[model samples]
Target chain A: MKRSNRLIVLTQFFLENPHTHTQLPYFVDLCGTTKSSISEDLDIIHDVFEQQGLGMLHRTTGAGGGVRYIPKNADAYDESFILELCEKLKDPERILPGGYLYMSDLLGDPKTVREIGRIFASRFSEIELDAIVTVATKGIPLAYAVASFLQVPVVIARRDPKVTEGSSVSINYVSGSSRRIQTMVLPKRSLKEGSNVCIIDDFMKAGGTITGITNLLAEFDAEVKAIGVFAEADDEDEERKVTNYTSLIKISEVDTKGNQMEIVPGNFK
Target chain B: MKRSNRLIVLTQFFLENPHTHTQLPYFVDLCGTTKSSISEDLDIIHDVFEQQGLGMLHRTTGAGGGVRYIPKNADAYDESFILELCEKLKDPERILPGGYLYMSDLLGDPKTVREIGRIFASRFSEIELDAIVTVATKGIPLAYAVASFLQVPVVIARRDPKVTEGSSVSINYVSGSSRRIQTMVLPKRSLKEGSNVCIIDDFMKAGGTITGITNLLAEFDAEVKAIGVFAEADDEDEERKVTNYTSLIKISEVDTKGNQMEIVPGNFK
Candidate 1:
């Protein structure tokens, strides 16, 4: 294969399998290139990645040293992305009875979800996460997307536990919207003790659901390292159950009577 | 940048944006390489892709011609993947009441979901799907995964319409497992009328949920191009509501009383 072709294949391999370490000799054999030549290629690839602000390619020195790619923070379109998202959230038709905006459209689109996941993954990349946790239903897709880019597995907390999942750990919490006691369950074997988890969800009204997940994680000695939501409601009357959390978009106001809404960017930083 | 580094960047760009067209001049400006050199690089990349069965690159002729990449069917580890998955499903503990298997763990893993998505995308690439459809909860992740690779949006059919989703269309279908009448709903504007959709799910018994989605699509005058699932029960007692569906693994038998189960490969080919 030509040197350029080898570069192309190597680039795809690394990007597809992020956070994986590969020995230099493995690339040497795959590219059929000399050690020195492979080293040079690595240098060029790393430089381009840095210049483009795509991500970082790290080289570990000493024995067992290898190359690993850590995705760069997705800040290139951070401002515009959030602006466009806020615009979408401002649609009056989306407002429901209890001050909620219909976000299924944004959550379902792959392109939209990819950007949201990238932003969340970028923000939380520094924290070592054992798994991305979310409640079942709408949040599953968002959790899966974030987990995919982070190269981690997703752990779903079910509102109703199924018999097929075997023995499970259950918790009771108050639903923010309904203000009713709700049961959340997770299989006992789904997560390991002492592992750090990142809680994610589609929306945050009173933030009751997120608190429930955090409390549930406590049973297994797991800690909630971070919490992320696609959107969060801003209501002066009702205080948020979970205080420390990040959201991509904030709903400042939702007027179902007049069919008007206000939205703004969240604390992505 | 050197031509080799340019090749690496270009490869990443193309792979990231699959099934999209780009003019040769875009590479010429980006890489600062001559048209002939860029063409030669493309040839090399195309050859390597074909040799590895990664995908294909096609060049349209005439005035508005450009190059496009179409991912080939993911066949690198088809046999092993199914064999390993079958092995996992055969675990007796996975069997639940009424002969269902606990597959939430496999379904939640991003890596596992990606492979499954690739297989489905590979099989349905030729169909030209506008959107991937599924019922709420478990199927959302699988649908999102497939839609991401296929570069389309996901349309989730909710079992119960949320007030937040605005107006919706509801349908009645029998639950294959419980043999009870159930309601499924989808937002009125969630999917475009007459759009071709691929129905995906995590599991299928009598395939009632998929049939429900199919019925819902018909209300909008849309067509069901294909249906794919990760697992399906092979019970002879109950007749399948939907025929001509694709599954990755088949559950031959689930002897919950005996604490045993049998699994086999599905119709990948």
Candidate 2:
């Protein structure tokens, strides 16, 4: 392949396979180029990535050494997208019964969800995590998106266990918003023992679910390295169930009768 | 910026935002280059993409014209990954009680799910889709992955409706394997009326779920443009409930007593 052709192909490869270490010979074979040429190409790619605030490239030397790409925040569109998202969240039209916000459209948006994942991944990038853990349904997309950037597997906890998943570990906890007891199940083999992981969810009320997951991971001797949520409801007067977590958006003072709500960027800093 | 630096950044842009059309001015601004320079850069990128059998670049030469990147099949790793997946599927350890295959590890791996999504996207790329619809839990990742590549939103159906989603359209359908009547729900506003969409699922036994989604879409007058599944079980003696669909792998003659299962590539053609 010509240099121009090789550059584009190699760019896509690194972006798709982030945090993966591959020997130089592999790129050389894929790009139909030499060691020196591939080395120069890597420098250029790394430089542009750094310049754009995209992320940093880590290179190791010796027989086992290789290059790995780690994606960071979306500097290009992060602020603008968050501002736009808050505006959407403030739409009282999104207010559903039981004081819940109807933000499924936002969650369903691929680009929006992907960017949210990137932002969350950026927040927890410094931590070494073995996997991204989340509950089933809504959290599944966000977990997969973060895992995509971190190049890690996503282990989902479901309300109902599947017979196809073999044996599992199940726990019961209070649903913060509804104050109802709920069960969360994880396949026994889905997570490794003593693994370090990050917990992610689409929405948070009193943080009961987060605590539940923390307890569930404890059964496997796993550690929760970090926690992230897309949005948090602050209308509750009682103390939060879980602390020391990150949220992208904060929603408060929801008025269903008047069709209005308050939405702002959360404490991501 | 120089052509080399511009090339790598632009490469990431198109890959991340597939199928999004942008006019010349956007690139000129993004790359900090002149219009002609941007045009030439696009050409080099487009040429290299076509040469690598990646996907065609659609360009228009008018006031409204812009370049759009559409990703096709993963010619590089499609066959090898599927073969490797088949080997993984054939492992006797994966056969669970009641002849279910324990493939959560495969579905949980981001790369595996992303590739499966790409393969499905390649098959349905020619069709214009308003969204990718899937039932909740297992299918969420695959649906989001396909939507990521297709530049479309994903609308997920739930077995249990959440009040947060507002009112919904619910339908009763028979579970293909369990032979029990069940309900699937889609929020009233989640999907627009008269849409064209593709249905994606992780596994199919009797195809009842796919048909349920089809019926649910019917409530909104939405068309099921295409259907794709990662695997299908053929051991059932009865005829399949649905037939107009594509599958990546076939599971047949699963012998739980013998602790073995037969798995092969499915009918992508």
The top-ranked prediction according to DockQ is: 2
For residues A77-101, could you state the per-residue lDDT of candidate 1 as single tens digits?
A: 6778889888877777777766657
lDDT of 1 at A153: 86
lDDT of 2 by residue, B1-269 (tens): 89999999899889988888889899899988999998888899988877776676778888899999987765655677788999987777887787788899989999999889888887788899999999987889999999998988999999988888989999999988888999999999899899999999988988989989999999999999999998998856767878899898998874546366788988885
Could you give the C-alpha RMSD of every candidate to the true structure, in order shown?
Answer: 2.2, 1.8
Q: Encode model 1's per-residue lDDT on B98-141: one tens digit a residue.
A: 66678888887887898788788878888977889999788888
Interface CA RMSD, all predictions: 1.9, 1.0
* Recovered fraction of real interface contacts per model: 0.86, 0.93
**What TM-score goes with each of the models?**
0.94, 0.96
What is the CA-based DockQ of model 1?
A: 0.70
How does model 1 fare in lDDT? 0.82
Each candidate: what lDDT?
A: 0.82, 0.87
Candidate number of the best lDDT: 2
Off by over 4 Å in 2: A74-77, A254-259, B74-76, B254-258
